[model samples]
Each structure stands twice: as C-alpha cells, then as structure tokens.
Target chain A: MSIEGSSPKSLFDKLWERHVVVEETAEAPAVLYIDLHLIHEVTSPQAFSVLEGRGVKVRRPDKTFGTLDHSTPTLPANDRGELPYATPEAKSQVERLIENCAEHGIELLNMGDPRRGIVHVIGPELGLTQPGKTIVCGDSHTSTHGAFGALAFGIGTTEVGHVLATQCVLQRKPKSMRVVFDGLLPEGVGAKDMALAMIAQIGADGGQGYAIEFAGEAVRALSMEARMTLCNMSIEAGARFGMIAPDETTFEWLHGRDYVPKGLAWNEALADWTDLRSEIGAHFDKEVHVDATKIRPMITYGVSPDAAAPVDALAPEPHSEAEKHAADYMKFNAGKPFHDVAVDRVFIGSCTNSRLSDLREAAAVMRGRKVKEGVVALIVPGSEAVKHAAEAEKLHEVFLAAGAEWREPGCSMCIAMNGDSGKPGELVVSTSNRNFIGRQGKGVRTVLASPATAAASAIEGHIADPRPYLFAKESA
Target chain B: MSFDPIKTLTSRTVVLSQENIDTDQIIPARFLTTTVKDGLGASAFYDWRYDEDGRPKNSSVFNGVDPETHKILVAGSNFGCGSSREHAPWALADFGFRAVISSDIADIFKSNAQKNGLLPVEVDEETHKKLLASPGAQVTIDLETCEVTFGDGEKGSFPIEAFARRCLLDGVDPLGHLINQMPAIEDYERQR
Candidate 1:
C-alpha cells in the first residue's frame, strides 16, 4: 500500500522479519520477540504456576501487562464494590490473578481500576496497541490489535508461560493471505457485518495456517473503531492474524494518546508507520476478494460463525452433512425465516462489539422505544472509561429508558463463566463472537448479531434488521 | 521440566466423526472456572458425553468405555478449531488421550498438544476411512518412528519435524531448546 517500498514484501513479512529473535533453521522453530504480551485471569494462573516451577522471572516485564477480564462479573451496576462475582469459583480466579501479578511484579488493571476493561478494548484505547508491533495474548481475539497494522495473534497457556520467561515464543512463519474488499459499503452495514460476511464466504477452516491481510478501498474506508471490530473476529475465520495497512486514519486515531511516542519521536513514528505497507508487487499465498456493496447486516444462525445469513433471507437449507447436524443442535428448522425468531434474552455486549461507537448505534435503535416485556436486555460497556464516556453522552439514559439494564464493564455473558447466561432453551441474540453450542450457557441457543440488530431485536422481541430503523431516523 | 515421555500409545479408539469439532465443544466455557487441571478430566466432552440435569449418559462415547481403557481419540478435519484456550488440549490430555488420529489437524491445536504431551497423528484418507469403520479398533502409535500400526497390521507413517519429534520423545517443551542454548544466546548478545 505504501508508495516507497520495493521488492513486494507483505506487511506480515515486514513485521515477522523484524521480530525474529532467533531465525528458523532446518531442525528448529523460529523464536519471535513479542513486543506486547497480554495476560488475563482465566489463562494466566496455570501459566504463572509454570513460571514459579521453573523459577524464571518474566523477561522485559515492562512490555507485559495483566488484566482480569474473561472471568469477572458485571453485576451491581454501581460503586458497591460487591466483588459481586457470579460464583465463589469466579472470585478465586480474580484473586489468583492479583496474587500472581503482585508476586511477579507485573502491572495489572484490576476490577477497581478506572482503566479496567476488556484487554482488547483498553489496549487500543490507551495506545498500547500500535502499528508494526508483535502482540500476543492467551485469548484468540488478540487479533483485535491487528487493526493498527500490528502483527498480533493468540497463543496457548504453555506458550503464554514461554513468553513470560523469555519475552519470546516459538513460531513458524505463517503463509500470507490477502482478502481485499473493493467498492463502497452499503447502508446499514458495518465492520461486524463485513467480518461475519467474510467468515460466511470462507468456511471456518479456510484461513488455517495463514496470516490474513484485510485490504482494499472498503477496508480503508472504515473508522479505526470499526476496523478494530473487523480485525477482532478474524480468528473466528481461523486466520492466525488479520491486519490492515496503517494509514492516515490510523495515525489520526492514535495521535496524542497516552502510550504513543511524543513530539520528535511522534514524527519519526508517523513516517515509519506511513511506509509500513506491502510493496507494490507483493505476493500472497492466497488471495480473496469481496464486493463491499454485496454485504448485508449479517448474523449467524447455527453454532459456528460461518453459519451466517442476511436478516431478510430464510434459514439456509443445510447442504452439508455437518450443517444438518449444526442446524439440529441450534434447533433451527430448515426453511424457516432467519428473521422474526423469538428472543428470550438480548445481550448487547462483548469484546466483539462493546465499544463507544457500538453503544451509540445501539442507543440510536433504543431511542423512543422500549424493550419488549419479558426480554432481558443487558448493555455492558467494555471498560470503565467507556462506561463514563457513554454516560457523558447520555447513552445510559436512552438504554435505561428503553428498559435495558446498563451494567458495569467486563466480559459478561461472553464466556458464561461470570454468572451471566441465558436459561436452558432460551434464545439469546448476542453481539459476541462464537455462537458455538453451549457458549452462552448450558443448552442456551445463541444467535450472533450486530449491536444495532441486537437493540432492535430487544425492542421487537425477535431478530429484526436494523436497517429499517436507521432509515427511519435518516428520514426523520 | 521433563514430564512423562511418550514412545508409544496402544489403546482402543473413541470416534467423534464430526468435522470442525472445536475447542469449545471439547471443553465448554462453563466448566473453565478452575486453575487446577484435574477436575477438567472429569468434564471433558461434557455436553455430548453427558445428559442434561448433570447426569452422565449411559451410552455416550466416553461413558460406554472405561476411561482407563481408551487412550486414543479419532476425529475428522479441523479438530480443535476454535479458541486458543489451552483447556482443549488440557482436557484431552487430562482425560488420558495420549494420541489423536485424524485426516487433518488444526495448527494451534497441534502446537498445544505437542507441549502438553498429546500426540496428533495425521493419516492418509484410506487409513482414516479404515479407522472410522472399526469403532473399537485398537491402534498403536510409535512416536519414535512416527508410525501408526493398527491391530490387524495396517501400518501408516505420519511426518513430524525433527525438532518437535525430539521434544515429544524426550517429553520436553521447545523452550528447553532455548534454555539449553542460553550460552550461545549470551555470546550473540555480547557481539551485538
């Protein structure tokens, strides 16, 4: 994408080659230096125990930061400090995170910290996520940071411990993929729709063993916030990482941030980041193209993210033998409309779509409307700063007046480990990634949708397209 | 830290004949609350391997066979496909599956399995089909030679990189390679 580069090295190759702490050999894996290592409560405890057993301190502790997200509660919507965990077991995990961070001298943004939020959300908000950095977390959604043109991906717990001890993890160079979306986006579509649409086209395993670069005019047209949402769900498509080339939009979004470079350093960084794109004739192992004009506000009906369809279309008849089983698991009868499905619970939160822009769109839908009776709608902010920012904009009043519970920021209902879940046989229209069976709760049917669709569905008490409502607002 | 080295695994196979059987299905998020790893063994494959209301299914794949008897898992393409939750490998390894035989294995899952003392062996389409036909078939995987031998002498060879093979055969993590080369790393750092 940059004009100055030659020889056509892809963005992934540029990032990977610079981070090679140890080059790969015929007999060994390459050791890549991790610029940012994120730790969370659910996956870090066992890893910390491994570190203790090995008696090795974290290498370059400054580059590592800890937060408790996946296992914390979002209840008590006030300053009650109830530590109001869903269960005693959840409490112990957070406590262990505190102990581990303290013992290891790693900084943690705990429940009470104002900066505390989902790791992916707070990382960019604080400017810890930047262009050309190699980041890793135990959660697969670490792909979220790739929006800033950084090479970020997830790793397992043993790899987590390995990075903790050495500031490096064993990795092989992934095959390169370029999925370019050309043309203008249609009305009422967003990054969430684009992501779901991508996964729908490429099967769940299509991007296996590849690092994908989401490119072209349509991807470049999105805001930084929307780009984050797009990159965040790249893992669901099975790509090791998804990236976009850093551009003016990226630099504008990152300018004057807390953790970014200052003054002279900022100008130098801006110049370097500007030149960070692939060369003119870069080659990829695989290439895919999507017409942005064709994408709709998409949602997943079956368990996998690939089971996506437009709100106007009927539930697709299962073609594969595996799809038939997926439909059966979701209890979605073939030939039924994907729309007008009844909703028992509507959750407007998750790392996938809980940012301020997400709240604005959801609140726009909730304005002058009330949630249908008997439908439990909870809108959780991604972080405390997000919570305050939304309240400052009075998004909270719109949500509360529309009969939804606006709660504190945390990873609620996404993991189902935080005591927030739909009851058995209940249908939940959620904005979270991974509608896998039992992901929300035991026997709970989950439909993955955008925040706007979730908000409209809460009011209609079923899955309804958000486009009509947004069109009404435009006309008004 | 050296754990138990895996040279061979001879056991009855349990078949999950579904493609893209993800990590979430292997171990659901609800049971991912503990730091300890033992109880996870009991809850592996909780939904399919159990009935609702917290009762174990009498005829499920896991319950029908003694956990001590079946030490191998047979699945289809894209197994362990979702979430980098090491819990998937932890649950499988804790449940005593020393090896998995599949037509294709996911990238992240293979790496996680290598470190957690679980072997992911890929076979040709014919072998996978033959393995699927026989439900209670006994299979022996020899890690030293990367060969899988069926009870009736149907043999197959799966490729393993030399470095990973040494780590698995020695029950060591790749980090051991780096730790062993600390002196060389020091020399390079000094020159820089």
Candidate 2:
C-alpha cells in the first residue's frame, strides 16, 4: 500500500512491511513494533509477575490497556455486597491485574467502568483499533480488531512479557492468505454462518502458518459488527490474524467513535487508510473462495469448530476415530437431523457475537416467543456499552419476556471461568467461538451457532434452522 | 523464566493419537485461574486424566507412563489447535514433555512451546504415522542437528525457526532477547 514500488502487494504484506522494526535474520525473529497492547486477567498475571521480578517498568505504558473479562462474574453482587467469584483464585486474578496496571501506569477499565467489556469488544467500540496499526493482545479473539484493518493477533504470556518490557514482539511474518466470499449471503444466514461454513470447507487447521484477509462481495457487504463476527473466529481456522481492508463502510462506522483522530488529523488518517487495500494484482500465498449463496445457517455438530454442517442437514456419520468419539460424546445419531438434537442451554454472547446488532438479531427472534420449558437461555452483552445501548432500545425487556436471563457484561459462559457454566452432560448452543471438549463446562456439549440461531434453538428446545423464525418476523 | 538447554533428548514417547487435540484438552479453562506457572502438571490433561468425581482414571493415556523416563509426547496431527493459551505448553512442559512430535503443529502453539522450552517438532505424514504406531519407542531428538531418530532406526528432520533454535540451544529466554532490542524498537516508533 505504501509507494514502495509498482510491485503489487497483498494487504497482509502491506501490514507486515509497515510493522517491522528490525528485519528477521537466520539467527533471530524480526522485532516488530506494537501500536496497541491489550491485556486481560487470565494471561497477564504471569507476565506481570515476571516483569516485576526483573524490576523493569513497562516500556510504553501509554500503549498498553488492561481489562478484566475471563474471570469476572456476569451476575451482580448478592445481599452481602460480595461479588460471587467462581473461586478465590479467579477473584485474585482480577485483583492482580488491577494492581499491575496501577503499578505500571497503564490504563485499565476496571469493574465499575461503563467502558469495560471483553478485551476485543471494547477495543473497536472505543475506536482504539484503527487502520494500519499493529495490535497485539493476550487473547486470541484479538483478531476481531483485524476487521478494522489493523494487523492484530494473539500472543502468549511470554510474548506478553516481551511486549511489556520492550514494546515490541519478536515475530516471523506469516504467509498471506486471501479468503474471498463470492456473491451475496442469503436471508436467515449471517456472518457466524459464513465463518462456520468457511472453516467446514477448510479443515480446522486450514489457515495454519498464514495470515488471512476476508474479502470479496459478502465481506464488503457486511456491517462492522458482522465483519468482527467473521474475523473473530479466525483462530478457530488456525490463522493467528484475520483482516479486512478498510473501506468507506469502515470509515463511516469509526468516524464519530472515541479515540479516533479528529478534524484535520481525521482527514489525514483517512487519506492513508484509503490506500490500505491490496492492489489488483496483489499476490497471496494461498487463496480460497466460498460460494456465499450456498451457505445456510450453520452449527458445529462435533467438538471442533470445523465440524460444521447446515442446521437442516442430517448429522454426519463418524468418519474417523475422532469423529466417533465426538459423536458418542455429543450423543447425536448419525442419520438424524440436527433439529432433533435437544438443547438445554442457549448462550448468546461472546466476542464473536454480542455486539448491539447481534443483540438486535437475537432479540428480533426472541420477541413474543417464549423459551421452551427446561431450556435456560442467557443473553449476555459483550461490553457495558453494548449492554447500555441494547437497554436503551429496550432489548432486555424482550429477552426477559421470553424467559431468558438478561445478564451483565462479561465473558460469562463462553469460557466458563466466571462461575457461569452448563451442568455436566448438558447440551448448550452457544454464540461464542470455541466448542472444544469441556469448553462450556465438564461433560457439557457445545454447539456453536449465530445469535439468531441460538435464540431460535432456545425457543424450539432443539437445534432448529433460524430461517423460519426470521421469515416469520419479516412477514409480521 | 529460564529453561534447560536441549541439545539432545533421548527418551520414550508418550502417545495420545487423537487429532486436533486442542488447548482446552491440554489444560481446561477451569484450571487456568492461577497466577503462577508452577504446579500445573497435576492439572495437565485434567479432564482426560480424571473422572467426574475428581479421582484419577487408570485408563487415561498418561497412566502407565513415567514422566521422568518418557519425556517426549508423540501426539496426533494438528495438535495444540484452538485457543492461544501458552498454558498448554506450560502444562505439557511441567508434565515432563520436553518435545511434542506431530504431523502438523498449530502456529501459535509452536511459538509458545518453543519459548517455554517445550519443543514442537513437526514431521512428515509417513514419519508421523511411524511415530504414532510406535508409542513408547525410544526416540532421540537432536536440536543441534534438527533431526529426530525413532523406532526401528527410522529417522526424520524437523523444522524450527532459527531464532527459536538458538534460544533453545542457549537456554535463553526470548523476553530477554526482545528487551535487548528495545533501542531499535524505540527508533522505529519515533519515525512513525
């Protein structure tokens, strides 16, 4: 994107070339400067402990931001004025992050902050994420920021320490991959479905060792929230980073948000951002295309995210030992439809979903529809901001009317680290990302779906297609 | 934290051949609330190693093996996928796996493992099949030569990033390396 030469470069190449502080050599990885560093409680404590032991201050505290999500309770305090933490360790994890951020002079959005939310959700909502910036977070869903055209990816605790001490992460450039979704997505299908369908086409590890750029007609047609949903699941497909080139839609969404450049600075930022796209002949190491029209409302039938199929399709027969194990664990009959799979729990929040638009999508399906008996549905907002926005629209009333627990903002049941979990052997249809074994809880089977699909399944007490509900709403 | 230098490791392999063995399986999220890195070995593969009542399951894959003698884990293809938890490698290292040999290793896990002194050696499909077939077979992994020698005198070379190999061979922490490059990083930031 820079005026390096007439040679065309992919978006990943452009982003990579911009972030290199020192070129990689045979003996060492490249020293890549980070513009923004997002940290959460679960992974940051050890990194902070290591930094404290070294007696080193954070290299650039201004660039670092912290929040508590993974272990924070979505339920409010009880009559004793005590937050019901999952365990003493989970409570201490949150406290440690607050202390560390204070010690390092880094900005932290603490418990009472209205801006506090999931690390990935708050970043873009506050406009801290922007085009052409290199962002690193201690959470894998940090790829959500990539939908804004930032070169964002997740890092481990050691890398977290490295970033804190030096403000740069050592890295090798990942090869570029371009996944283009052709044509228009049909009604009743959404970004989560597209993500699931893409992963199903390409195995769970399809994008390994590569940085993927989601492009083409469907990607361009998506709203910022939908794009985030699509990109948030990149890690499930084994890509560390998933990005979209910034366009007018991105600029419009970010224009009035907090932390964005203003007035003359805004115009200058836009000028540079317009050049962020890959050129016509830009080369990608790998390229994949999905027929958007053929995609339907999809849900994972197995433990892995890639074990996805259309909601109306029959459950797949065990193809391998792993599949057989997954089938036995999931308790799904090979020839039966996913619709017959009973759902005991429905969770409609995570970094992957739970944006205001995602909330609206689910609320539209839940309005005037009662949740089926024995199915406990939870509607958690991704951030405090999203919660307030949805509340302003009275979306909570609709969920409450439908018998869903309208909960506070936090990861909640997604990671099951916040005392919110499905009972053992329960089947939960979740809008969150991972469905790995015991992800929701011990012996809990997780089926990943979109917010709308989750809402419909909650109403039906089974894994039902969302198209009928969506169509019924349209006609009404 | 520092790790022991791994020049050559000759040990029997502990095999768990289920493909796409994710981080959640390695160390479930429930056991991840700790701030410190120590004592995670007991919880490594917790779900697989324990029954619902919190008792150890004798039929677990890790039951028969001794951690001291079998220091290498030869797992299925696409091992360590899903979450970006470095805890996965930390748990494995604490459980006495000095190396993880697989046909395909997830990108982030490979980086995390190398930094934590748990080497991820990715072999070709044929070699992986051989490794899978011979679970406790004695294997020698030479970091200096970047090669793995396994059962029946079969051998294969594995790929590791040069910088990671250097750090592993020298027993140096990558954080220290990044800290040393701070001046260059500041220079780049100033220009921006």
lDDT of 2 by residue, A1-476 (tens): 54656688878888888999899987888888899999999999999988889998898999999988899999988998788898999999999999999999999999979999999899999999999989999888889999999999999998999899998889988888999999999998999999999999998999998899999999999999999999999999999999999999899999988999999999999999998999898988999999999999999999999999999999999989999999999999999999999999999999999899999999999889899999999999999999999999999999999999998899989999888999999999999998899999999999999999999999999998888889883523
**Per-model DockQ against the true two-chain complex:** 0.65, 0.86
Using Cα atoms with residue i matched to residue i, what is each candidate's TM-score against the true structure? 0.96, 0.98
Task: Tell me the TM-score that candidate 1 gets on chain A alone.
Answer: 0.97
Give TM-scores of chain A for all candidates: 0.97, 0.98
Tell how far residue B22 is off in model 1, in angstroms: 1.6
Report the C-alpha lDDT of model 1 over A1-476, residue by residue, as the tens digit.
55534457888889987777678887788877788998999888888888788788876678899888888888763475476777788889899989988887889998778999999998998889999999999988999999999999999988998888877788878899999998878989999999999999988888888999999889999999889999998888888799999999999999998899999999999988887898878889999998999998898988788889887788878888788888887777678877758899999888889999999989988898999999999999999989999999999999999999998888888878888888888999999888888888888899998999999899989888999888785422
Cα lDDT for residue A218, candidate 2: 94
TM-score of chain B in each prediction:
0.90, 0.96
